[model samples]
Target: MPSLDPEEGDAIRQALGLDRAARPYRNHYPAPGDDPVAGRLVERGLMERGAATPAGLVLFQVTEAGARQVGARLPEAEAGR
Candidate 1:
């Protein structure tokens, strides 16, 4: 797994979980105070920022490397499900 900062990664994880199941992107937590995991991922080119729309949303997607990183890090419980 990539060395993501837990706090930041957790935020991203939370954001990912909020999607409606059909959107290409999801919104982040309402605030962008600071998240080390998110910062490191973005800094390392694993995550990219997208525009914040008038609807109050920000978008993000996993890079190819990021997809691999997350895939590799899946917990056994989640993988089985």
Candidate 2:
């Protein structure tokens, strides 16, 4: 995978809500036109695209690897492993 630059890292953090608190597992639904970095994130395997909304907007969720990249704690089960 490609290394994350400052912009990409910041984007991942924002998507995971790490910018606010430490919400590592929260899902983010960016505005339809606000997904330039999102595609790159998905390509990097840090985030995955979820189901589409009624209006056709896609849901984006952080993966375990993505959470770790941002220094966010994994769930108990995954963490224990």
Per-residue lDDT of 57 in model 2: 78
What is the lDDT for 24 in model 2? 59
lDDT of 2 at 50: 72
Error of 1 at 39 (Å): 3.1
Return the TM-score for candidate 1, rounded to 2 decimals.
0.47
lDDT of 2: 0.68
RMSD of each: 8.0, 4.0
Residue pairs in steric clash, candidate 1?
none
**Stretches of candidate 2 above 4 Å error?**
23-25, 29-34, 74-81
Ten residues in sequence with the least summed lDDT for candidate 1: 72-81
lDDT of 2 by residue, 23-74 (tens): 5545464545358777777888887777777887777766777767867755
| lDDT to native, each model | 0.48, 0.68
Query: By how many angstroms RMSD does model 2 differ from the true structure?
Result: 4.0
Model 1: residues >4 Å from true position, as ranges?
A: 11-37, 72-81
Q: lDDT at 70 for candidate 2?
A: 68
**Residue pairs in clash, model 2:** none
